[model samples]
Target chain A: MSGGTTTRVDARGGSLFAGSASVRALVYVALAALLFGFGAIAPTHLASEFVLRIGAGGLLLGMLALSVAFLMSQAGLVVLGAASVYGGVGYLFAIAMSKWDLSPTAALLFAFCTVIAYAAVLGALIVRTNPLAFMMLTLAAGEMISHSVMLEGLRDYTSGADGLVVTFKGAVFGMTAADFANATQFWPIAWSAAWILGFAAFAVRRSRFGAILRAIQENEERMRFSGFGTYLPRLAAFVFVNAIADVCGLLHVLNSGFVSPESLGLSVSTNALVAALVGGVANSTGPIAGGVLFAFAQDQFGAHGFTQLLTGLAVVVFIVLLPRGVIGGLIEGARRRSVLSSKRRRTA
Target chain B: MRAHGVIALLIANSLALASLLIMLSSGLALIYGLRDVINFGHGALYMLGAYLGYSIALIGGFWTALVVSPLLLALLGIAFEYLVLRPLRGRSHIEVALVTLGLGIILGQALIFVYGGEARGVDAPPALAGSVRMFGLSYPLYRIFLIAMGLGSCTALALWLRFSTSGLYVRAVSQDPSVARMMGVNADRLSLLVTSLSAAFAGVAGVLAGPYLSVDPGMDVTMIVNCLIIVVIGGTGSIAGAIIAALLFGFVQVAGSVFLPDLAALAPYVLLFVVLLIAPRGIGRGRAPA
Candidate 1:
């Protein structure tokens, strides 16, 4: 905030409004083409089904991390129970289809609306607290959902610890269960979902509401003194992030054909958090990349049965040693170079 | 008067649970009061204490384990203050808390590695093993011991906070750190003391939990969650409020388990949300963050 004008301008942003716009646009188009080509071709190039499966899973996780990062950066509130929405949407989807006997598309819409309502109600109750209390409440709420799933009374609905197998025949978003479950077929779906969610988060972060949210986060008292409501914007932000997680969770259920208590557990939420930290909470891409990075790391670490240990270590190391995150750090370094080069050009 | 006996049993059960919770939550509340950072590794410290107690009890007796565990934990507490807390003093409270959460996960996983995934049980020393007739009802003697310890610690904590110079300093700092520091209070020195003391209490609670709750890999998460709920409900940094919240949480939990077994696990969470709704800042006189 105290930085000089040039320093404060965010050189790395190099937004579309800047000079040499056509060149940047060409670069972006080329990048998009490259990404689209990768999404189409990577499944075939990767020989092993295991790698493709993990890759798809990584995209889903990255989307979840994007939501987590969005909340953390914009609202200055860390949600420790993102899995509730992520897994809750899946559970609601399964329950809606199996119990209500709704059609696949109806169930998908029903599940999405129901979970958003849940997020609204939950967010309304929680978004008024200090950040620390807010974080703890989210954790408690996540555990509550996980525990609720295991209750004998809810067993018939949730399938207790065994979880529910959700297999839908008709396409909700034009992809059947079989299509989603197949590794190669699922890759593009996951990739597209990641891109959409990432873009949505980025757009929201750049919105006027995003400015208000950041301002409230910076100083709630001052915002209040300035006659801002302070509560509704935060509540909206909470529901927004949860909506992102809801979409990610739906995709996960579609891909896996399974919704279990474990998915709603604290571990999954922390995993998303760890992914966000590793990728950097500053931007949308960092979290998605982080999700993929952590997923692959977990895959390796799982072989040694040190996944949990590594998760703990990663949280500490990322926050302490690399607070900007791997991607955030890279962006910072790039921005610094650009600024320095611009300084030299001006002098010359 | 069987109904009376049943009520007595329920209260006793809740008190036993609250006893351990009081020890754990107070430690958490104390640290939050002084440093303004919740020790997310607190549950891990308790778990470490329990695991260490399990081994020590095997070598000596439960008595020896109780004496030695807190002493060992005090050293770890000192190390934590010097090694982790002091170094990260400049970071945001949330960041520090996240670091502790990470440290906790590492510690918990390491313990799991050493002990494997299985739960370990420790005998309650022959003296407190059997049930005793209390108020015409047969009650487990170990529970009575636990309740006694809970009351003992509460009194000790109250007296210390009320009478001692350090206690006065702790209260002043907790109420307003900036003002306390301006008055020339050595906050770092005080933080070291409080951190170690909190760790020692957590150790003591862990050692006691072995015979009561059974030492398991999952216990740390459960206890930590419970402590977090209590601290939040009590109003984040208020020690007085935390004690009351622990008691309330324990009663709700115990009663739920007895009457609503199906939803017993979620009772505390229900209590938490309800409290949060009614008093978002919590039931205590916790100062808002500046």
Candidate 2:
């Protein structure tokens, strides 16, 4: 339990690199290389298109999962309403771009600003409440927003649950103009965004704010006593992390070619939570792995409803048996044995 | 306009709402107050009860299901306690909450797989099938029967908890399980009993509800959300609180829909938010069965 001993053991067992920034940067490079390699070698046929579509979808879900995992693992915030933030911002982006003829860049900027506004206002109100209260409030907020959108009055804006489709012919930094013309064309942008976000999250976890958040999670009262503004750090983290979720939503709409009320539904929120928990909320990579697994299972079991049942079972099993999540549990176990052997050596 | 007709409709609706609310909130209140575990699976249990009733009514008779379904569900509740909740006894309440949430999802999806995700219904028995005239207005006799059954069950439960030795132990365990155990009361047994009783109540509610509402996979989500709102507003763990909260919510829901159908869905949350702002602990906090 000594901090030094734990750190030494973690270092020795490769736990440091297991979810570390450098490792994730390497993962990003590897994924991009693999995708490019596959695109290069695959026969120009329908099968490659299918593979690319699924891969892109997996990457989008992974990005969403990564945002949630960062908040849950790094900050100990179980945000059941994370998907609403994602879907809400996406909806806003689509409406702004398609209905009002706002430029895609303006829409994306508006969506991010809206998410920050939402997080600050709602986070400040519910941040002091207990976890259950916060969760219920978030659920209520999500329901209210969805219902509002679905109402006849807002139908013109939200399309009243029928959903809205937007055409994106914009370029980011002129990196191949209008590349999102098709799913295959859109893959590079989505993957690059995921890589950049994942890298930034990894960097954040190493920063002073991350340390303070960890301290607050461990002993908030003590940290408050030491003159730190606990609430502000948590609110900032909430805003920051949810902004990333909004970006995922933006990419999701751009890649999927449409958005629907189902995206903001309770099931979607529950799915995000499940993915984050199953993948190991203790690290960013866990969600990436978890997201891909979840999306694949979803497609495979879509016909029979087996995927939902399996996901629920996995969540229960992971929580009950693997309390620290898959990766965290393995790393912790290795660290523990290493500490034990080192102690035995010192005793001898 | 006929005053008597208006009065009759109001009475009938009030009675129906009260009956439904009591049935839904009792078990929720018990598990929450006693075990400090919010059984998110309560809704699934409710759905199970309805499905059980539907099948029994279809095969044997409606009355047979009215009797058999609750008993079966009570046993299921006991099994749930021993299997899932017991093992996770000392974990954080939130962890238990999440696990039960997972269990709810599994149970709900499994029910869908078994029942084919279609809506099912049960017919009221012959005696309770038709409407009865009261104060110059006709009201469904089945609704009246439901009201009577709900009231009778509440009375029986209240009496048992007040007069029985085991009732005292349940109350003690709810207040502080460790102290109750120190005093030689079997906390685990009492927990199982309460959980079973709660599930049984939900089953009875399901049987009554099946005729009024469509029995479908979606029912679990709707019932759980409504019941959680009631339990949270009325007070967590207090049977009296549950009854009061449920009645209040039932009236608001029914009346709100009658007045403004469009805004009806938002009524409960609006009420919940107002109450939370004024009294976050709910209306009957300190009055929980402790």
Candidate 3:
């Protein structure tokens, strides 16, 4: 009788995530390749440097959103503090280079690993809670990181909100700091990173581990009863998404050659979330597209000094009207049209 | 100053901060209990109240602002219930929360546009502005009034929840919505009441915060994050737990500022993590997780 009741409860437990991620992996790869190709070549062809720079920023934001969307889709958890890992990685890199006099390459490696560890430690604690609590904790944790960076004690190291300008002492991944900072040069790099991160997210979503994650998210108790360790999968997913955010953050700092408290602010994380919402959370391309779209919208609104106002409006509109996000909505529309045409042909 | 004097001041300060926090977090907890939705815009509402209070106080006095802000917010609370909350009732809680967050951003931006991002100061009425001596230590009277208001509200909240039919319904819905619905409890009506009451409390907290914390565009975000941390630490829907957590948060924040000075801003977060480490489910006697 108890077993029967448990299964029944499990059936209705994941109503929030009943329909998602049905597309095959091959499709994801093909779409990613197409996007990467366009992103890589389009910047070179376009004459406007301003647009390319904005596009690069969008790709970076998209990369961050990809991480956010993955966790949201797979784990039924929203991360409100992704900016910490993203911005924190940059701060560590700059600090390592400046304070410890480490080579840029070494600092890059050190910062990446450290942020991964930070994510692991943070994820271990936060993933134990329910989804809402998880969301709340992420936001708090993000704020904690932001505050620490501005600590008066760390003023010499972090510069106390004046921000740290990082000049690479040695070649990082065989590219000079100047190369990374150039708008035209940075565009392809950001585009490539977005594709790599997008594929990483896709691979995780397709793997057997991904299946377990979805199962756990859908009905954690059922998965646990069936002998799966639900905790580790979630913790792993948390780290995995944050690692994606970390990579984006590193790339962001690399391109900008600067890191500030603003990078780690709640607004940064919210922007990524808004991008995820605008683009759709189910697949990689959606978030990337959403990021690009948000970047452009921000640029437009920035002119009017209404960036945040539009951002807030966008969040409401997208969540209410475009629940699946722009890419998701567009895909759905195309699929519906195809189905309608097929039906007409069949009737004829 | 003597060690005892320092201790006394610490306690007084914590009580003042905790009073404001309790006023904010309790409203957040109550609404969460009733609706299973965290109003991410609670901070923006608080900001709105502070701004409104500033304007109203300029025309009348601090007393008038305190009284009028909550009444106006109660009306907005009703509108929020019928409009935002009701329309989004069928949506997922996360989605609804996101919408509230978005609305919060919009509202915050609107206030910033009007107020132009400068911090606004509201003077305490002449009666509460002066310091009073107690036990050989002088303390600000406004904070004393704040503590009194805090204690008064707590007593009122407790009494209402203990004796009233609506309050009981709220507790019932919060603890077990399905069971309460099966019993034919009108959750919608209860939610409406909770929403308005919570908004009113946020208004009160905002007005109180003006003389204490200063009114600014950024206050909404900071207060919301603090309240969110408190709510999470207290266990999402646990009202009693929220109050206790607010007290703890208040003490930690105050003590950190007084003692550490440098790492003061991060004190509440440290307190939060320690509590979460010890009790993953939170420091609350609330319902089991879904």
The alpha-carbon RMSD values of the candidates against the true structure, listed in the order shown, are 2.4, 4.7, 6.0
CAPRI verdict (incorrect, acceptable, medium, high) for model 2: acceptable
Model 2 vs truth, CA RMSD: 4.7
Off by over 4 Å in 2: A1-47, A74-77, A168-178, A203-216, A219-234, A333-348, B1-15, B286-290
Backbone clash count, each prediction separately: 0, 0, 0
Residues B1-290, candidate 3: write the lDDT tens digits.
Answer: 99999999999999999998999999999988877788899999999999999999999988999999999999999999999899998887888888999999999999999989789888998999999999999999999999999989988999999899988888888889999999999999998898999999999999998898899989998999999999988988899999999999999999999999999999999988888899987799766544
Give the lDDT of residue B84 in candidate 2: 82
User: Worst lDDT window (10 residues) for model 2 chain B?
Assistant: B281-290
Q: TM-score order of candidates, best first?
A: 1, 3, 2
Q: Please, what are the lDDT tens digits per residue for candidate 3 over residues A1-348?
A: 874454434443433434434543556668867966986987668748899889899989999999999999999999999999989999999999989989898899999999999999888888998887888889899999999999999899999889999788658888899999888888888888887888789889999999999999889999989999999999999989988998899999999999999999989999999999999999988999999999999998899999888889989999988899999999989867755655454456
- Model 3 local distance difference test score: 0.90
Q: Which residue pairs collide in model 1, if any?
A: none
The lDDT per prediction is 0.91, 0.76, 0.90
Chain B TM-score in each of the candidates: 0.99, 0.94, 0.98
After superposing candidate 1 on the true structure, give the runs of residues whose Cα lies further than 4 Å from its correct spot: A1-30, A43-47
The sequence of per-residue lDDT tens digits that candidate 1 reaches over residues B39-145 is 98999999999999999999999999998999999999999999999999999989999999999999999999999999999989999999999898888899999
Poorest lDDT segment (10 consecutive residues) of candidate 1 chain A: A8-17
